[model samples]
Each structure stands twice: as C-alpha cells, then as structure tokens.
Target: MLNVRLSIGISKILLSAYCVLGAAYTYAQSQRVVVTGFTGTSSRVPQEVDAAGSEPVNALPSWEAKAWKGETIHNQVLLQGGTQQQQVSVTAGDLADGKGNRIPQQDLSIGWVKYVWTDEFRDGCGYRKSVDFDSSLVADRIQTGTNTMLIAAGKAQPVWVSVRVNANAVPGDYTGSIIVDNGKKITLPVKVTVLDRVLPPPSQWHYALDLWQHPAAIARVHQLPVWSEAHYKVMRPYYEMLARAGQKTITASITDEPWGHQTYDNYPSLIKWTKKKNGKWSFDYSLFDKYIAFVMDCGINQRINCYSMVPWKIAFRYHDEKLQRDTVFTGAIGTPAYNEFWSVMLRDFTRHLKKKNWFDRTAIAMDERPMEAMQSVIALLKTIDPAWKISLAGAWHPQIEKDITDYCIASEARFPDSVLIRRKAEGKNSTWYTCCSEKFPNGFTFSPPDEHVWMGWYTAATGMDGYLRWAFNSWTARPDEDSRFVTWPAGDTYQVYPGPNTSIRFEKMIEGIQDYEKIETLRKTYKATGDQVALNKLEAALNNIRISNFNQQSATEQLAPYRSLLND
Candidate 1:
C-alpha cells in the first residue's frame, strides 16, 4: 500500500491505465447533459430523475446528508484500514438553466479534488477498498483514473466512490469535492472524519493469498513477445493488484514453458540454453532479469518464487553454433549429467540473486513432483547452495518439511489437525492450494462471491497463514469470452480478466482477507487490553463463521454488524 503512489510519471501511468478507454471523445457537438448523483442499491436508483432538468445537479455525492431528497444524497462513513466504497447513480438529462432555458451543444471538463481536511485543507485523502484490511489500504486512494468521460443527453452511469485511510493518518475531519463540468458548474461535497486509531501495516497481515501470475499470458493477451516492454506494461497492473491483495511472493518462470501439458508445445523458454563448441553448457539470464525487475518495480519486493527447479519432465535443447543444429537434452531426476547441469545452473542463479541482494528472499520452486523426485532435487540444490529455500506445490512430504521454505499443499492432502497446528507453532510458512479438486469454495464465476471471501477466513480457521491458486492470469485461449480451458472449469484457468480488472470472485476473496485481518486485529487489541470478555466475543465472531454460510450474506454485509466491537 505504501509503495502504490511512487510516481513512475503520473501522466504516463494514467495514459497506460486509461488505454482501454480511448482518447477523450468530443462532447461539444452533443446536446448538453445534466448529471446528478443519488443514493442507490444494485436493484434501483432511489430517487426519480428531474425531467425539467432546470437545475444543475450535484456533481459529487453528499457524505453528510441525513436523507436523500432526490436533489441531494448524503452518507457518512467511519475510517478503516481496508478500502470502503459506496456507489451513487449518476443520471443525465437534457441540460437546462434554473430559469428553464435549454442549453445545448457544449463541452464540459470533469475533475475532482483530493478530500481535504475541510478544517486543515492541506491534508490529502486516500482511498481504501476494505474496512481496516491491511492489504487494500492506501495512503492516497482518492485519485480517479481517466478523470473525464462523455455523458450522453438522457442516460445514466454509476460513479463508484471509494475512500481509504492509511494506518497512520491523523485523526480529523477531511473534506473533498467531485466537480462535473457542464458549461454550468456542479460540485458534490465529500467528507470523512478519521477516528483515533491506527491499522498495522501489511507486515502484520496474517492472510496470505498466493496469486500466481503468468507473464506469458500477459504477452499473449497483448500480442507481444515474452519479456518485451509492452508485455511488462500490460503485466504490471496484474502484479500490482496481487501486491495490493497482500500477496507475499512473486511467481516467476526461469525456462519451463507455461501450461506445457507436461511436454513442450506452444510454451516458449525464457531461459536460453546453449551448447558450446567444446561441449559445455551455457545459459542466458537476460529474460529473468527483465521480469524480476518488472515485478519488483510493481511492489512485489518481499519474496520471489522462481518456478520451477524440477519441471514436469526434464527435456531441453541446446543449439550448437558451429554445427548449426539443435540438440535436445533429456534426462530423469538424478541423472548424473543432468544433475551436474542443474547444480551448476542453480549455483549461478543463486550467485546472481545474491549479487542483486535477493538471495535471502528467493526460493527454488517446484510443482507436484513425486516425493522421491523432490528429495533428489533438494539434494542436488543443496550441493550448490545449502541455504537455498526449497518450495513445492503438492502433497506434504513429512520427511522434507524441514527442508522446505514454503509448502503449498493441496486440499486433498487432508493434513491432520495436529500436523497443521504443529506447523503453525513451529513457524513454518505453509499453505493450502486448490485446483481441479476444489469445488464449493472456488473462484469460478458461477460460484458466489462469498466463497472467495471465505478463503481467508477458512485459512485462518484452519491454522494456515495463506491461500494459493495456480492461475493469476493464465487466461484461456478465448480469454475475452471464456475463462474455461479444456483441463479445468470455465473460470478455473483465471480469476481475473486481461485488463487485470478483477472478477467478483477476486473481489470477494479480498473481502475475506479484510475480514480475516479485522478478526485478528480485534483479538490482538482485546488481548493487549486484557479484556477477556471482548476477546471471547471476537473469538465467537470468528468461530461462528463457516464456509457454507458465506453465500447467505455478502462479506461486507456480514462484517458490518461487528463494527462496534472493532471500533471499541
């Protein structure tokens, strides 16, 4: 959250963010449109539109009105660490002056000011997506993307307003305004009264959702080569979104092709391996550097998971420059020559990461290798760098738990309660992952958003520190229209679309993470004050939650009633 506003050229970033919305369309040639904001639910806009359209409508939604009078709307909010949002429906009508004179064919500029402290106007306001959730909290959340859009003369669109108060924001009343230019001026007031409390930074967050990213998918979506700047630009938003969701590790590919079906096909290698004239092995790591830097720049700086040390099947080719031919290298785990090659490669890679000051946070990742193969791979890796962190995404290998830095076990592994509890107590960073096997609580579009939100709560309930899903943006071939691939459910291939715009499932998952944080925060706060009664109440709130019950209420709705406990 703290790293979000590091300006990489605000205008350039805005252009990139608004690329989907084409250049500003001319509004002068169209009939002037009236815009008004009103309280609304997903089902209906609460107020009737003014047909007379004589008065300029409020451009900003009210943050303090007691009731909606159709002409003005007001709602108040309490500051929280996570993001909080409210939507106001904006309707447009034929423009007219208060004197009932119709004004037509004019262009208007649109803009909004950072919510100032009305009292201390210099203090800026940021936006948040969840209530007191560390991950989505932003120090500067009030800025809108592509500030201008043309409103047709008799149409309506919803202007979603969101606010976030950072963990350390000073307590006071803050005010801001959203201005809609229609040749005539209309301003809507926004107000916030920050309470005297601070949220812990993300380092204290307990829920970890490992959203694995597919850079190749990004390249395909943008029609660019892997590691190209164009690819990085399109991929930045996705990684940043994950970072905002409290993702702790960055997933990277060294050379293994993505979705290779356990064999090489359309997937291209990022690591280039070459066979020298003297029969020596050489690798080019230019691609890895570009990708790692790209992800780090987007705020995924804590850990790097370079997947994978052991690929599904070890088969790679090296080109012979002198002979002008390619030689495919193939071997099973523990083949003397293959082991030697990987030992050298990993040694070089470890040295590279150390040079970049990334060795400590780096892990050599593997996916679903057999226990025997995993042991062999670990042995080979340790020969190169004894301190190298080994990460595996598969069933738990009890014998190798001590060797693993992060073990993402599948749900079907059915790890016993004792083992799970022991792992947590031992300070081992482990988690659970779901793929084709997970059904009820999943990220599919058909599934309720609550399931996504339930993930964080479930993880906490089960004594796990995080959750993991294989595909971040592993889009289907027809990603725009469908999310399903041949091997998995329709939405299983990806939880988000190409724009890096989120899906309902993703939104709900965030809600769950926020809820998890709130529960943990409440427990910590009560414990610190030695209030056993309040602590028991907080525990009851968590104990009462169930994955099956999530569908009954949206996460926000269910969590709202506990605000008194949280506020106190």
Candidate 2:
C-alpha cells in the first residue's frame, strides 16, 4: 500500500538569521526548523541532540568573523594529519497554524539532497562509517542521509559532518555546501582549510599497534550466518576506519579456535587444516588470502601480525587421515607433534606471505603467555626459520627482547625507559598495549577525553615507537544491553559501536595522534633553528603528561600556546 499526503496553504516566505550568544549561529526557515552549527565530542549526535537543553553546545570558533557568510558555516581548521568534524541541528520550525498550534515533527523534511565538492579537499568521511574516503578517488557530488527521523517542532535533530583532509592535500580553502531537499532550497556552506603537514603512511606509522580484529563478532552483531559477500559489505567500513586512524598491523587468525576455549566459540579461523586419506597434513588458505587482501585493499598496507602460533590453553582439534576422524591434541608448545604441525604451517604460511610480497612485513604473533611458553614458541619459530619475524604482546621478557622483532609491552609492566628508546633508535619496533589491567589511561566510556588524547602524547614522550589497544570491534556478547561484558569496565571491550560509529574515546585518541605529530614537527623546528626556548616549552608540557593519569588536563589548553609556533 502506498500512502501520500497533499498540502495547500498560503505561500509564506520568511527568513531570519538568528545568532546565538558567543560562537553559534541559527537560521530559521519559516519557524519550521532552525539549524545551529554544532560540534561532536565523544558522544554520538543523538545523545548530543537529546541532551541539548541541559548541556551547552559547541561550534567551530571563528578566528575571523568576516570570513563566514553564516555563523554555522565557514572555514574550519584541519591539521594535515588530523580529522575535523562539525554538526548542525535541524529543529521544528517556529511557525503557527491558523489555529495557533505548532506543526508536528512528521512534517519536517531534513533529507540532504547533495554535497558540492569544491577544490582539493574533495573527500568526505562517509556517513556513519558506511564507506571510506580516499582523496586520490574524487567525486563530483556526495549524497548523504541519516536514519529516518521525525523531529518535533521546536526539537532539534543533530546532523553530523565529518571531513578528513589528507596529509598531501593542498593547503587552501576547499568550498562546498550541504543542499537540503526541503521545499525551501537551503544551502549550508562548508569550507575546509587544510594545513601543510604530513601524516605518516601506514607502513611508517612509527606505532606498531595491533587492535585485534574479530570477524566473528561482526557476523554475530549483524546476525549473518557465515561469512558471505554480505559479511564483507558489513565489515569493510570497520577495517577502513582503522586504516584511516593510521593503524599499522593486520591481525590475522590462522586456524579455528586459536588454541583455547575447547567449547563453542565464534572466532573465525582463516585456515581449514586437514589430514587427507593419504595420511598427510593439508591446508586451505582461501579465506585467509581473501581477508588479508581485503584489509590491504582497505588501505592498510603494512606489517601483518599473524596471531598466536601459540595460545594460552594450548590445545586444538584436527582431522586425522589414518583414523578417518577428528582428533584432539592438548599439550604445551614445542612438543614433537605440536612442532611438526606448526613447522609445516609456518613454512607454508611464510611461502604464502612471500608470494603476496608480505614476507618481510609478516610476523608470527602470539598473545599473553608464560615465559616457558614464550621460550618454547620462540624456539619452535627459530626451528621453522631463523629469519622469521616474531611479535609478542605480553609482560616484559628481557631474555628474549633482543631476539623478538616486535615486543608489545603491557602498560602494567616496567622496563627501563632506555631499553625501548635504544631499541627504537636501532630501527626496532618498541610499543605498548593495555588490556583489562591498570585502570589509568584506558579507553572506557567513563574515561575522560583527556585519557584518550594522552595516549599518543605519552607514547611519543616516553620515546616508544607505537601504542596498541586490544580491540577494534570486539563487541560484548550483549552489546545492545550494554557494551560492558562480565567484569570488564564499561568501555574496555571496544572503542567503536556496531554502526562503525566512533566513540568519543576513539575521536580523542586520533586527536592525541595529531598532537604527537605536532610535537614531532616542533622538535624538528627546534633542531633546525637551535631554539632552546621552544625545546623548554615542550619540556614544560611533557612534565604535565604523566603516564599514571591525565590529572584533569585539557589537551587544547596544553597545546594552545604552541599551535602557531609549531605551524610556523
């Protein structure tokens, strides 16, 4: 059944430019809806809109008012390696019918018609993480939409606008507009001012962070049976998001169940291991090849961390040819049979990586395990090939630190600061990671934006090469009920929700990464000019950046005095 409605009323043309006190502007279209330039913090747009009454809204602060035609739209700053976002709220119009009553929310038409891409800042961060933007690939017009919503008259519906100016983007004003399809032709101006600086490419990100990717969790969240083309469609945006965030490592699983949880689990295995009727081990890499290629295709071309040649529980099941049945093996790492199985697997895997030109970029990665397990696995890996790269994310293991290609230190562990600084100097990767340990500097929902933004600064300050947080899309079993699972903190499980919609924490972390780049930029300037004062100011700032806590610090306030200096 098709439903339609018709309206015939006195033609009214009303225009009012209302400016809010301070840095906000609102325009009304015949009292039907009003829009004010807004900004998104760590919270989602809906939450921001719903809480608009009690909380003060934020907008892009204009350095020069004359540059803006309307208060809501104009030049916004996007540092070369950073992300900038703006929001506008569409509210019920302030018009009255003949009966002196306001119009209903259902009458509002906030459908965005098209986006005008002008100049070099042509890329748009796709709506709600639905698609990724690559600047090399330009588009004439971008059509955007939000969920179907009916905002009541006088109530505001916030719309999100995000733009990522590429590191190589020409530094200038890129003009554009959001054209609304309402009866009134309203155009909102968009001018992105790209700065002159460069974000490191994925391969040289300097941070060897590995935020684990779980295909199974995505499948469960979207309620799809098995990984199909539909699963790929649901999954691409997430990998793309991480890639854009300057993520360097690719988390790949080898076989099913990953050596733990001998019961039902959802973690997808890339390899289908089998023993044929001829009594020889055989393997399939179809899915493994596809997923890695997919992630690389999403623009994450960097080190590949194939996880857990050894896991905690130390067990797995495989088909046996002689018995013509499935067999279970439960034992420690480097046992004869265990060594035999992994020998073939790792050798073949290395060959596969070589075929794909990922051999030097690949690492045999392992999770948290005891020192004995680490030693055994390291030994077994050496037996496979002395030159095979290895990655381990766990407690401090000094005996093996020099041998490991990448050692991801846990936040709780203490190693002499000089160890990592020296390692980084030697072109070795020294990084840090945090899981469900020490509550400080973690990315929980309740954790302040300062916590998220401080991580990158701390990494750079401590002279660590990179940082890692455990999960990308590892959603809770009952993500809908609450993202918190079992005993973990409310947001410790994941930084992003199902829609690939970012959390405030994720956004703040990106802010911190940009801050780190700014610091690097300043250091270079200081070296070239022999500016001791600039070096002194950087030292003073670092004094406030304690690893244990933010101490309620404001990242913006800390960076304010140095912004122009670094840019200069």
Candidate 3:
C-alpha cells in the first residue's frame, strides 16, 4: 500500500481512533448499563457484559440488541410471552453520566429494574450478532435492512414523542414532555415514502470506457516503461469501454497477483508476494497514477483509491492471527495506530487529489473501516473537512444498527438528505454508499439491510453496479473467444461498426433487465400491489442476470487465483 507512518500528528490520530471506537468505555467500565447505540449487527460493544442477569432482575424502558428489540429482562431471550418490557436508559445530552454520585434511589420506568446483558460477541471474537436477541425474530432478515434496523438523520431530525404516556399504566396516546436525555434516548417514528411514477434507471454510479479509443491509441500507452504493454492491451481498453458505454464510475485497484476471470485481483499489494514491481514490499503507485490520468481524461465521475489491505505484515509479525484477520477486516479493529494510519492515508490521498485538481470532481471512499482506521478517519475528516463525504465498510465490529447511527447522526449532526440538499455554494450533495456487500474473494457475508435495498443496477443511481453488467475478455481489435468486441472478423467491423459475434447471454441479461423495467416501474407507482407475483418476476429477471454474470465470473474466478492470468 506504500502508506507513510510515524510522523507529525500520527499519535494524535491513533489516540482519537481508540476513544471514538468505544475503547475508552470498555477499558474503563467493563460492565456498562446502556440503552443507546445498539445496532442489530455488524457492530460491537467496546466492553463485554453478561447476557443474563442474576434471577432475571427487571429492567425498564425499551431494550434493543442489533436485529431484535423489546422491553424487559427474560424478554431479551423471552420472559412472559404476552408481558411487555421496556429497557430504559437516559438519553444522550439530556443528562451527564452519573459518575461519582451516590447511588440514587431507583425509580422503575413503568415498574422495571436494572438487569445484566452481555456483549453479544458473536460466540467468538468481533460482533456479528451470531445469536438473536429473541429466537422469535430470526426469520425477519429483511427487517434488519442491511443488518441495521433504523435510519438516523444528522443535523436536525430531532426525536420527539408522538404518543404520550402517563407514569401509571394505561394504554392510550398521552403527549406530555420531551425526554431531553441527549445520549440516552434517540428514537423516532419514520414517515414511510413511496413513489408515484416509474423513473429511468440511474446510470451515473459507474464509469465506462470509450469503445472508439481502442487498439491503436490504447496499444501505445501500454508500451511505456512503467506498465506491461500486454496487460494494458487486455484490461485498459475494456476499462475505458465500460465508461464510454455511459457507466460513469470506475474503480482501479493495484494488483500484483491473479484475481478472478479477465479481472485480475490486480490490487496494489502493500505486502509480500504481490505480482508487480518484482516483489517490492513497498509498492510504487506512480505507473498506476498514469493509468488513472487516462481514466481522468475520459471524464470519469467517481473513483475509489485504496491502498487499504489487511495488514498481513503486522499480524504475522506480532503473531496474532485474530489481529491478522482483523487487519484484513474480520471485524472492527479500532485502535490508535489504526486510526493514525487511516487518517494519514486519507489526508495524504486528499492532498494528492487537490494537487491533481481531481479533489472536487469525485466522491472518494475509504475502503473497509477498521476501528483504528475509522477513529483517525473520523477525527481527521472532522479537522480537515467536516463535510467530507466518507464511508465505512459493513464488516466492522458492531451490534450496530439505527441506534448507533442515531448516536452518530446526533453526534455528527449531519442528515442523509442534507448531502442531497447542499446548496451550490455549499458543494456537491451526493452521498453514495453500500452496506453488507459481498466480500471480494469470498461470497457475501453479514446480514442484508432492513429492506430489499433495490439492487439499483444502473450506471447512475448504482454507480457501476447493475444486474445486466456486461464483461467480455478484452476490447482489443484482436479476435479471441474471450473478447467482447474484437477486430477481424476485420477492420471496419471492429472499428466503425462494433458488434457481438454470438449473442452471449450478457445481452440477454440486459434484455431481461429491460423487461424488468416494468416491474420496477410498477413497484414505484402503486401502493397496494401483488407482492408474491412481482417478487417472482423480479427474481426471475434478476436471476437471469446474476446466473449469467456468475457463469462468466466463476470462470474468471477460476483462472488466476491471484491476478496475472486475466491480463496475460
């Protein structure tokens, strides 16, 4: 990854990362009584606790853990089936931590007492919500909505009680007072939104290449000293074509090994056994930079620059496999050094962008946030630019959900729509993100989001993500079994009039998607529609694309376990 280390402010970054990641809470108070910041999954408690209490002492207010939410003690697992429970805790900012005060006489929140709860530590290390808060809610996977249950608004979506309540037990709406417990409580009712008409597929999320600039022009760029001409001939042209096809977003990973299909795991290796540079430990991205310039020339919109890799180097050196895997992101590994390094890279990358004048044009993403990494990233971004569009991988240590987001939004105070509503003078209001994504080498892990996040497979709304994405071997004029559009069947065919030799199902998949446009359209316009039938059609259409794409990808995956196989 060629990341710099041990410099000015590195320590500060690390320290902050540690604190922000809940390290402070865990280290100081192992057994914490908490109500806010509970995600159904993908996040964890910095401190560990007991899942069961002694004799099931009662606790009041609503209780929530990752995917499941309830209001009582045994109810966390299930007490009285019909009895209700509420796990009450103070709201953030409403009051300060009652640190150093005498144990005040307790008041039952609608007659509830404090009980013990554990770290829900996914049975081993890191938080994945391996167990359920209640066995009853296991089947409702979609409700997690990307393994998270709620959405929090930053800036001004304040929490106000819609229905009121009396101290005594009664079942009716009772509007009384605002619970100002800032850190303690932050929940609200959601205004469900539905669309009236069908809209066109968004095609800006991806950047494609121009089919016109292939062969000659691209062939020349590959011959330069820093690049492998043949590899350039294979991949570069297609990358360009993908954008030229109106796919506006592109991702350029540095690779030194074989990856999958025509696609090489071509990631820039920061450690040993990398493919390029004759096995240099510290990678040189200079040549890659040139290729990026090529992409820039084509007017690509978004780009994700990642030197981020699992720190196999550190994990092996320290002899901590868990740390090693965490280095690669088994879960959250928030630490000061991680934070320091993360902020360092982000800061440096931000600087590089400014120098190249590509800073404002693209939305930069910091891949896979390690606890340590995010600690520094959050703080650094706050310092450098609070408004910087940032993102985190869905695989961090968390039982995290809407509560945690609620906490983050409240603390960060920025709304999702705010990014959508920024004024011209303010800057771009585009906030793009993905959650619970399939791991590159492995298939998908972690639970899906609360709802079926409409795999919006177009260029714009989804960037380069689409159900009918087409990938042929290469874009060279050379005729080969693998290539998408080749020369010969001859010059004019490959040049002036590009065409597909055989109708590879790739086109059929696109047609399938085109056919599905109606289903998607209907999904938007009507309120009460047929769910099962529409799902079946959507599934059939989507699967046509998935199965087709996978057949191609599975083939790609097999060839080069590392990278070069695709390029060569």
Candidate 3 lDDT over residue span 145-228, tens digit each = 011112111111111111111112222111111132222434421111111222243243221221212222233324432246
User: Candidates' lDDT values, in order?
Assistant: 0.58, 0.58, 0.28
How well is each residue in 48-97 modelled by candidate 1, as lDDT tens digits? 23435433334324543211011111121111111112122222222222
Question: How much does each candidate deviate from the true structure in C-alpha RMSD?
Answer: 17.6, 13.8, 30.7
Error of 2 at 520 (Å): 2.0
| Structural similarity to truth (TM-score) of each candidate | 0.67, 0.70, 0.32
- The clash numbers for all candidates, in the given order, read 14, 6, 114
Query: How should the candidates be ordered by TM-score, best one leading?
Result: 2, 1, 3
Off by over 4 Å in 1: 1-161, 168-195, 201-206, 258-267, 320-323, 412-427, 546-568
In order of lDDT, best first, we have 2, 1, 3
Cα lDDT tens digits for candidate 2, 1-568: 1222222221121112222322232233333344444343333222223343645545442222111110111121111100112233323232222344322233222322111111111121111111221211111111234523333444334443344443444454555444433334455554444445555544455454567777778888888866789989989998887886778888887755663642123665787778788867788889888988898888786778876767655556677878878776676576887788778777887777788788888888877778887788888878777878888888898998987888888876755778876776766788888766655667665454556666777776777777887777777665433443444545565776666665446656766676566677667868899999888878676766566433454544444454354444
* The 10-residue segment with the lowest total lDDT in model 2: 65-74
Stretch of 10 with least lDDT, candidate 3: 66-75
